[model samples]
Target: MMKINQHILDFAKVFIAINLCLVIYSFAFESMHWLLNTQVAFFSSLFITIASFLSYKRNIQSRISNLDMSKTSKTEDRDKIDEIDDPYDLYTEYEEIPEEELTPEKIKEIINDEKSKVRKDSFKNTLFSAGGFLSIYRVLGYGSLLFGFFALNNNGIFLPIAFMIGLGVVPLGVLASKLLFKKL
Candidate 1:
């Protein structure tokens, strides 16, 4: 994880530098058409922002801790009191295997435990991002706005459409998402 983080940080520096150059060139030259314009960047940024926000929420979520079998005894002297009165198996248990009996097959359980933790935490976050994004709407919205307003010179028609979909859709989508997930 640390290695990947270091590699991404190194790549991000170059990526930011190129974007800076592109911004400067777009403004400095009149005839030079910027391949990626402000509208495109705005839509991209919006999608990225939404994804990052969801990821941030996922990162802070804590999973149920698994038991370390070595510390606990195999024998149950008596039934423990259930204060919560819930029958759900929250923390998973592992049968304590003798250290000398630890083979290649037993090691898979340890690997699977870690993998399960990661997958469980990220499941909802992954589902949210899979369908929700601005790019799909932006390509359909931004291109039409720029063409209908700028090319055809109809500010009156374009402004309302742009503002409603551009500014309004995010909140509406978020509300819809919350309702769908029962998070509201």
Candidate 2:
């Protein structure tokens, strides 16, 4: 899909840009240790962020699909209205459930139903689900980042400032990609 391709392109751009800088630094300053330190930190963080993004994207897509499947006659009416004033449906749609029919018990029932759904979708329950926050890949990503950081520090190869900079590469890459690829 286009989304997957875009992610790959962004990743490639970021990876190349950061490593290119490191390559030049290694040649000019002749400090391979700095390059190694930065690389480990950058890579581990990249793993974590990318895994998190994929999980989140999958979660959103599933929710959208569920919504699409549950469309009803009421929603169909709204679709006709949306074609008039708000052609794109850019504004939030209000429910047709009238205020007069909203009795105390009805409100309570609605609230309870929503609460139950929230409980079902809670982070703890979804931790290892397909689109979960703590899915296996994400857990591994976090583990790699944590262990990599500790290993670097324990071995006394920790260049504190450089390591921090390396950790920032992904975010910087995201920004750069957005700027460079923005549609006019």
Best by lDDT: 2
lDDT by residue (tens digit), candidate 2, 1-184: 3455765776677677876887688668857777777788788888888788788878777765755433323456566666566654557566678899999999999999999889876954465355657667799998998898899889888887778777887788777777877732
Give the Å error, residue 33, model 2.
1.7
Q: What does each candidate score in C-alpha RMSD?
A: 15.8, 4.9
Alpha-carbon lDDT, every model: 0.46, 0.75
On the 0 to 100 scale, the lDDT of residue 62 in model 1 is 27
- lDDT (Cα) of model 1: 0.46
- The list of candidate 1 runs beyond 4 A from truth reads 1-8, 31-36, 39-50, 53-184
Query: How well does each candidate superpose onto the true structure, as a TM-score?
Result: 0.27, 0.68
Residue 48 CA error for candidate 1 (Å)? Answer: 1.5
Task: Report how far off residue 129 is in candidate 1 (Å).
Answer: 8.7
